[model samples]
Target chain A: MNAALPILALFTLLALALGLYARRGHDMGLEGWAVGGRGFGPILVFLLLAGEIYTTFTFLGASGFSYGSGAPAYYIIAYGALAYVLGYFLLPAVWRVGQANKLVSQPDFFVHQYDSPALGVLVAIVDILALIPYLVLQLTGLGIIVSLASYGAIDKAVAIWIGAVIVTLYIVASGVRGSAWTAVVKDIMILAIVVFLGLYLPYHLYGGIGAMFAKINTAKPGFLVFPASGQSIWWFATTVLLTSLGFFMWPHSLGACFTARSANVFRKNAIALPIYQLILLFVYFVGFAAVLSVPGLKGAATNLALFKIVIAQFPPWFVGLVGAVGILTALVPGSLIAMTAATLTARNLYGLARPDAKDDEIVNVAKAFVPVIMLIAVYFTLSGSSTIVSLLLVGYSFVTQLFPALVASFFPQIGVTKQGAFAGIAAGVLMSAWLTFTGQSVGKLMPFLPQAIKDFNVGIIALALNVIIMVAVSAVTARKALQPARS
Target chain B: MRPVYWIALIPFVGILAGPVLHNHVHPFILGMPFPLGWVSVWLVITAVLMAVLYALDPANAGE
Candidate 1:
């Protein structure tokens, strides 16, 4: 391995140590640690949200997808902007309820609003299940960074395991405060690296953005066009919508939302997040530039497109910097995911399972679960059964199942009973699984559904079906509840 | 007036309208490609929509 181990070791140690140090105040209790005492201001919220947005996927997978497919990869950039646009209106309502009730998890909101523990547990199980693939995506990204940075000196499996262990340790030590403080540093590094490389690479190779796109357009017109052949209109539309809705449904995002000091913090974060997305637009273009500059790079390892370009094209020190940035990308989200998962397990599962558990004990359990979940993610990363996109799809579909119960919980007059909600969720899960396994896109299965409905990406189709079943069952069971008679 | 409620719909409208307009008229921005055109226009529309939403409702402003 010709890589510089000293630089790599130094940066990793800095991030880990800083993250650990940040946890001191948070370690006081579960609430303090897990949700940052529900006191995050706009800056912390901004970092947390940005950290969630730029995963290893942005660093590696976005470019790979752009290289392999075309134009469709821009959806990553597009959907994020759209998510914030949608959230501007939606989030304040959610924040209001969260403040009113002191809701910890998304499931907590559902349970309190709808008066249903069964529904909460169902949401919790779905969240945990969905998070597995999502966490694995981060772990896989971390593994790729390690493997590439070490230049085959370290086994990918070992690198993933080591990275996961480090993330789990810090998250367990500091909780949400650890995530918030680290997120601030992480976002700065990400923005700096992405902006620096984004401008430098295109200028070095293609002369400018227009020329880059022109070169790509001449070679692969598909890269410039939408709904590229083999990528259906339905798939395009639904994938965007499903991802937009699912963005907020992510447990870590909910955790961040809960941390906001006030509704205005969330509002400011919502408005400002798109500005971050605007910065990421450069990152997306980096993927397109990779296609133009480095064509016909062959193998089953298309995921290495951006990394290969960096290592093969850039100087070694710059490569190390990008590697460190990628590593930070993985670390920030990995810590948040493990922390969020641990929180869910501690608050929803362990607390519910044993109602009298002390806050400290629950916090301890959360800390313990972080390592266990990270290890599970590491195992999957090493196993490498699926590509990054496939893993993300699985996670997206699964978390989408939470939408109906959560949305209905806030509305109250949705008249969805707990039993009905459970049934809906179950039906949604089964249908989504069948669609996913059968190799049918969710858009194709429900043609009559609206663009928003038909384009149900991931498990959102199942969620829609779940909602339908829930409302239908509730109506059948209690006419008065559904109708609310004449005044 | 729930400014956010309406602000949120701007992107939805742009998303719906972007493809529809692109398919028919082939929109362009400062002579760049229309797909890029569509995104830029949609982004502006979404932003304006959000600003309008904030102005209209301003629910959390006092809080």
Candidate 2:
């Protein structure tokens, strides 16, 4: 009677075996554990990057957005396609810098560029803080996926523990290489499940997508597109801009940049990634179909729209398999997030703190952080309030604050001083967090400003201020340097 | 003297141009909603644009 135990356990074992096999015969060192020895070709790089970016957020959340809200879901497609374009231009240069510096982690780039080990430590701390929430999101979603698919045959806490233990063990044993290989499996299964559901659900329920939309649009006019005055056109535009900018700034993505054998690998993936995102369009279709067939989903229940439709429409075994795929979606990205957080602590923080720490020692130290990171995430998962989740969610934009400093690092003539970077980052994070918190607390930050710009994400507004501070500080420092000094 | 990087900005702007194009839901294309089609069109164009930008790069020219 129970579908979750057999299906999830089998695939989890298979995935664990595959993950373990991925790192076999590879030497463990800073390079291996952090960047997969920087030897992956274009194809592996594509799968790893794609798998990393398309997590449970893409699988469950996007469709739910479509089911619950309608047209704003298109931002998922808009931001992703846009992000790869940004990535295409920005990442190759990053790869070049990383290669030149022999950088294994994101903070390594920060250290080498800003010429400040202290900055590296700051980056490591900020990166881990930013990542734990994302990891917690994945682990929490995995728990729900396992229990839901099993039809409550397994307890949600049990599912969460199972996912946490497996993810921790495999990531520690295999590192980034293990993460990439498991990604290959996750990607194949996800694409299959998503595509099948996207095509079959619409036709089976509503005869076709055209007919399905005809009913939804008839019932609820303007549900298909964003409103102009309230959200305004700029609202959508700003979110796409802010989130896309935030995309590459993520430490896992930055670390993924160094895994490539060449910078060209990033360029090729940038082009290919959009085509991969077209899959989301199908996911949108699933969400819209859930609206018509499985109506009345509310709040947290909305996220269950896609999976509920699958369980209702498909056989129990297929439902179990879909559940397995969902778990993989969570685990694949969770492993990468955990791996990067560990890598940042080991390579950037520990290595900087103890500069004499050996290569193998750094690698070992990072491996040790693997379980610690997961356990901390699991602890937060168990204990964290909605307020805590909101706190971390606000931090998503704090990572984007690093964009100005990061861009300056690539160009020495930009004159971004170390103090300026520090001041700018602190201001950016503080302002961005303040804006997000106040908005959540008070409902809106500015009622006086024009509806168009005022409706936009606070992160971009904070980012604009961040850029000004960095430039102003840099100009002052630059001018001060040029001025003659008296003894 | 010109920056090819500036040219890449065109595609980025194009990607965000959808919601600002219109406020209503009546207009549809390719048997889908307007925003959906707008994003799909840009998604394809983004791929082509990145490919072109790659070709234009002197660093990648040796290939």
**DockQ of each candidate, alpha-carbon based:** 0.38, 0.69
| Model 1 CAPRI rating | acceptable
Residue A63 error, candidate 2, Å: 1.1
- A73, model 2: CA deviation in Å? 1.5
Tell me how far the alpha carbon of residue A82 in candidate 2 is from the true structure, in angstroms, after superposition. 1.2
Model 1 lDDT tens row, A147-243: 7876766677877877887787778778777767777777788889888777777778888766666677777654566652235344565677778
lDDT of each: 0.72, 0.79
Q: lDDT value for candidate 1?
A: 0.72
Q: What is the lDDT of residue B42 in candidate 2?
A: 84
After aligning candidate 2 to the native by TM-score, how far in Å is the CA of B25 from where it should be?
2.2
Predicted candidate 2, C-alpha RMSD: 3.2
Give the best candidate by DockQ.
Answer: 2
> Which candidate tops lDDT?
2
> For each candidate, C-alpha RMSD in Å?
3.5, 3.2
* C-alpha RMSD of candidate 1: 3.5
